[model samples]
Target chain A: MKITPKDVAHVALLSRLEIPEDQVEKVTGQLNAILEYAEMLNKVNTDGVEPTAHVIPLSNVMREDEVEVSLARELALANAPEQDNGYFKVPKIVEG
Target chain B: MDYSVVIGLEVHAELKTKSKIFCGCSTQFGSDQNTNVCPVCLGLPGVLPVVNKRVVEFAIRAGLALNCEILPFSKFDRKNYYYPDLPKNYQTSQYDLPICVNGYLDIEVNGETKRIGITRIHMEEDAGKLVHSGNITNSNYALVDYNRTGVPLIEIVSEPDIRSAEEAKAYLEALKSILEYIDVSDCKMQEGSLRCDANVSLRENEQAPFGTRTELKNLNSFRAVQKGLEYEIVRQAEVLDEGGKIIQETRSWDETKGITLSLRNKEQAHDYRYFPEPDLVPLQVSAEWVEEIRQSLPELPNARKQRLMEAYGLSSYDAGVITASQAMANYFDVVVGHGADAKAAANWLMGEVSKVLNASNISITEFAVTPENLASMLELMQKGTISSKIAKTVFEEMVASGKDPATIVKEKGLQQISNEGEIVAIVEAVLAANPQSVADFKAGKDRALGFLVGQIMKQTKGRANPELVNKLLKERIN
Candidate 1:
């Protein structure tokens, strides 16, 4: 499918990314070119092969339910832009 | 015009595991903020998540208990969303290949059993909790605690088979009981260990296609589930009656206002682009393991209810009330095992024990009276050491002091007065004091006999054996 400016804007919105209006066409074309380059796989006829979920042949990678040490509260919030009372504080997300 | 209300429920129960699903962080509730955060749970850079083995086993146990087909292969998927609760910007959930499918749970409403089809039960990670500065609408900002992040949760989705609010409640209650029976979830709504959401719509008739439905959230309790659906049915019916088209949207149950307010349109929020999670490997369950879990499953509520009816000779209603919680049913068994008669134990549990529990707002586990104490108390009444009325007083004292029944009965001098001669003297004194009542008794006022019995009971502090008092009073006044 061809990438449209509207599709680019929607993806940017969902990803919380701000795209300049002038660069919309450039981004759209760049996305379409990438998709075109990756579209060559569609021409190969391998319909009988089962879809692969992962490249590795691993399954059941798990650990026992045991509690190890967790990071200290100060260290956990060290990288946060804003914090209050040992919590990560963010802007209000009002539901419509 | 009456419309047929269609409802379906999605229940999310946090698994009772020691650690978070993908990390070794403690999943203990009510801990200090962010103290349970690990790099994996906090979605830090270059960290991989490993599944908790116990979480898988719990999911399998839940699936078998609900009579679901355990899929041999299952995998986690990334449901991409931009919610603040999810630190990863996506929730790790099962999109298509859930662990369980095609299961059904039977719920009884009005003494008729209705089977609600379980569409699927999938494993997922829970989001962190958000503490708003104020209400959601007016909050300047919100605080986030990642303690609940990465906790294992299983989402059981039901088919659109529920028809009314009562049936919906029955369905949720049954699910909770089964979950509790298998020891998977605590099912505590107050702590948010258990939660439910509903999809509700109204159609013109049974055969009519389902109208556009509204998804409801914040149904934190079983009562909220029922009340929200009931309110939604009325609201939808009104909309349809006014010739206004039903809008597909997500609504929040405003418990304080007792009304549902629209949250957001469905179309605007429906874009969750799900893709298979690559970091976690697909799960391959073996038949032997599933069998082991099935065999280890405890007797579920329905089976326990039936056994209670047969083994204890209890009525269906009594069995139902007793088996509603695994703890209650186990408590009943312990009481009976301690030499209390089965039927009598059932009665006391349903009557006085339940009354105390309700008034104290505590569970049977938290009750002051132990099973041995309760059984011995019942034995005292059965042996005529205490009258039934006196038993209640003894029970009250036992609850207050947490002492044995025999000690309480002896300490308060509340033993039944069964001696015929002693009863006769009290009876004669009562008759002489109330000569008019005696004259009335001779004149055939049966009520006078009752009044005499009351006087005798009062004189003896309600410890008189009622049967002996009745026989002795009759012979004296004859």
Candidate 2:
């Protein structure tokens, strides 16, 4: 398929991205070109083959149920845009 | 149109792991905020997440308990959603290929067994808790506590097979019991270890297609789950009957108000663009490992209830009550192990023990009376060493002072007045002191004889053997 301007806007909204008003058409064209480039795989045929989920062949990368030290309160809250009483403050979410 | 209620539940239970799912942070609840956060769980840049082995093991165990088929190869997918409680922009969960699938759990309703189909059981991480600054509706901002972040959770999704709210509650009770038996998760609703979101709808009889479903949330207890489902079923039915359509959305159960309020409309929908997590490797659980986990499983609640009923000749309802909790079942078994009669043990556990537990708001595990002490107390009553009335008094003393039953009986002089000579003397004193009752008994007045017996018992401070008192009084009167 072909990409539409509305589809690009919806995708942008879902991703929380803001495309400039005039750049919508150009950006949609660029993204559709990339999609077309990626869609070339549709031409390949591999019947009776399993879909691959991981690129690496390794499996079961896990750690034991052990406790490691957590970051101190100060460092854990270091990058918070807003902090109050050792908590990360966010915009009002009344319906939590 | 006549409608039948259809319900499906998605439950999330936190695993009882010592550490968080992806980091070394503690998974302890109610801890100081932000204390259990690490660079990995905090979603800091340049950090990677390692899956927890115990989490997968627990998911498999829960699957086996639910009689699900385990998938040898499974992987995680990122559920993309932006929320304040979730520090990461996405949640790592199993989407298409969950670890366990096609499971079924049997629930008993009105002495009939109803099987609920399990669609899948997948592993995920718990989101952090959001604490509103003021009243939730009036609050201007919310604070995030990362203490619960990254806690391992297993989401068990059930097929829409439940027909009523009672069945839904039974399913949850059975599920919670199995989780407790397998020792997978804490499964406490109050502490937020176990949470449920229900999908409910109403269709006209079984011939029609399933109706549009609404997801119900914030059901904090089993009662809430049942009551909320009940209310939603009626609400949906009323809406459909009024020639209106049931709008699909998420509704929060106002537990105090006893009604479900719509929180979000379906017009603004969520499309979680799921993709395989590239950081974590695919998990391959061997068949041998699954078999090992199955072997390690304890006797589940249903089978244990069956055995308890068969072996002890207990009623089905009695067995259900006794086996309600693992601790209570263990206590009963221990009491039987100490040579106490099974039926007698069941009676006391269901009656007196439950009374104390409910009154004190404590579990059987924290009860001061030991199984051995209770068994010995029962033995004392059985052997006529103490009257049943006196034994209750001694039981209170045991709970208060933590003393042995025999010691309390001996110290309080609460033993049964079973000696023939001693009771005979009291009987004679009662008879002589009340000639009027003697004359009345000779005149065929049974009330007079009962009064004399009562006087004898009161004279002995209620320690007199009731049977002996009756026999002795009848012998004298006749």
Worst 10 residues of 2 chain B by lDDT: B263-272
**Model 2 interface root-mean-square deviation:** 1.9
DockQ of 2: 0.72
Cα TM-score per model: 0.96, 0.95
Question: For model 2, what is the alpha-carbon lDDT of residue B431?
Answer: 90
Alpha-carbon local distance difference test for all models: 0.93, 0.91
Please report how far candidate 1 places residue B424 from its true position, in Å. 2.5
How far in Å is the alpha carbon of B86 misplaced in model 1?
1.1
TM-score of model 1 vs. true structure: 0.96
lDDT of 2 by residue, B295-332 (tens): 99998888989999999899998898788788899999
lDDT of 1 by residue, B1-478 (tens): 8999899999999999999999999999999999999889999989999999999999999999998999999999999988788899999999889999999999888888889999999999999999998788889889999999999999999999999999999999999999999999999999999999999998989999999999999999888998888899999989889999899999999888999999887886778889999889999999999999999999999999999999878988889999998889999999999999999999999899999999999999999999999999999989999998888889999899999999988888998999988998999899989999999999989998899999999999998999999988888899
